[model samples]
Target: MSFLFNTYALARPALFSLDAESAHELTLKSLQKAYDCSLTRGMMASRPELPASLMGLALRNPVGLAAGLDKNGAHIDALGNLGFGFVEVGTVTPLAQPGNPKPRMFRLPQKQALINRLGFNNLGLQAFIANVRKSQWRERGGILGLNIGKNAVTPIERAIDDYLLGLEGVYPHADYITVNISSPNTQNLRTLQGQDELTQLLQPLQEKRKALADRHGRHVPMAVKIAPDLSTGQVDIIADLLPRYGIDGVIATNTTLSRDAVKGLAHGEEAGGLSGPPVHELSLQVIARLREQLGASYPIIGVGGIVSGRQAKEKIDAGANAIQLYTGLIYRGPALIAECVQALKR
Candidate 1:
């Protein structure tokens, strides 16, 4: 494990030297090569044991790889082998897009966080499904959630159309589906969280959820991925609406626009949501608040700034059915996943 970290650290300088967005693309390309060569399979085959059950899906572990890491579903099998209990791909829109302009993603090394305004840069629904169909990873026997959203050009008022389209396309392929209404980069996307708008937006999706279940003879849970920037009032509203709309669970955060913890740092002023240590406390606060509103029965997936076993446990204690990591993986490597699962067992 330490050797992996050492090797990654040795390569960090080279990766960091490139523009953030470009570096991301290069990393994905490298991962694709690794997958093609079966190197990732050989390296990640000795999987850990950390089974968990949430929302009727049996996860191999409680720690999952969050969305954004595999925005196009290209590396599902490769990532699944790396010991994640589950993997989520995409913030996929109905149509493909190039996302925001260059220099849209930044790293705050000192704070162990990432700030990215990479607006749903994906290969669109048809292309994404085609990749999923071709991948050996999707059939690897683990939990997979399809995270859906609107295209960058779609008007906020009509976001549901895109989400529904995404649901229709990926519903059969995904073990579950995540509705992402909280990403801050897309203009006015977060407005869907408002009481009136949210209620209206969710109604049709809920209806489709039922229709799909009946049509396919399979029940795929639907979860809402919310931002950590909301106030208690907003959280309360969400809590009230979740069960009312038949939403299955909540992914406690989707990153934060606040730069409180890394203020004045090199990438502090980057215009994107920040994730890592800065959002840990706030993520816990949101989970706890949601727990209060929804009570112990509601399922919550806690994510943000969880780089250690103790941090993972803090989220569980605050009321998370499971937890996820993205920036932490970037900072600590795959060993952190086993470490977190082991620590949670204690």
Candidate 2:
């Protein structure tokens, strides 16, 4: 583990020199090559077996790789080797759409933050599913989640159609599915978080989930990913709606539109969601609010700005039953996973 950590430390300068998106691509490709050579097996073996339960699924640990990291499910086996109890992919849309324009992703190294308006830019559902099906991680008993969202061209009124299609397509393949209504990159997408709009969305989703469960003879849990910019009242409203609509879990935050924390830092004024350490407190607040409203037992997959094991433990103390990582992986590398697992274990 120390060697892996040292390796990433040595490579960090090169990864950082490139643009964020290009570096992202290079990292994924490198992980794929490592997996192909079976170099990842040792990393997997060194991971602790800290069994946990969340939304009725048994997890090898409570640490998970969050969505948006592998949006097309192309790198599940490679990422799973990094010691996540589960891996989630996609914010994939029903149809393939080129996301936001170039320079869509920016890094704020000063703050250990990133601002991306990638707009669910993915290879569409068909290709996403194909890649998912090609992965060996699921057969290895790792929990995999498929996150669903609407396309860029799809108007908000018709967004339900896209989510329905996503649920149906990813159902048989996923151990769980996440309904992503909270990405800041998509226009009007966060409006789905409102009470009336949320009601309209969740009702049909629960109905569809029931039908899918019956047909597949298995009940796959659905979690809603929410934004960190929400008010206490807004959080409470969502907390009330989730269980009423039979949603299984809540990923406490996506990212924050608020740049208050990153002010004066480079890329701090970018027009996209700000993630990493900047949003950690906001995520914690949302988690605390959700736990207060939803009660102690309701599962919350806490996310946003986790960059360390102490921060990971802070999330768990804040009301997260399980936690996921994204920016942290960028800043801390694979060692953060073991550090987090150890923290939670302690």
Candidate with maximal lDDT? 2
Best by TM-score: 2
lDDT of each residue in 1-346, candidate 2, tens digit only: 8777887999999999999999999999987887788555564344557899999999999999999989889999989888889999998998988899988899998888999999999999999999999998889989999999999898999999999999999999999999999999999999999999999999999999999999999999999999999999999999999999999999988989998888888788989899999999999999999999999899999998888889999999999999999999999998888899999989
Identify the runs in model 1 with alpha carbons over 4 angstroms from their true place.
Answer: none
lDDT of each: 0.87, 0.92
lDDT score of model 1?
0.87
> Which residue pairs show collisions in model 2?
none
lDDT of 1 by residue, 1-346 (tens): 5544565577668887887677777767765666567665475454667788989888878999999998889888877767788888998998889999877888888888899998888889998898778766556678888899999898888888998899889998988899999999999999999999899888999999889999999989999999999999999999999999999999989899898798889979989899898999999999999998998878899999999999999999999999999888877777788888898888
Q: Model 2 off-target regions past 4 Å?
A: 39-45
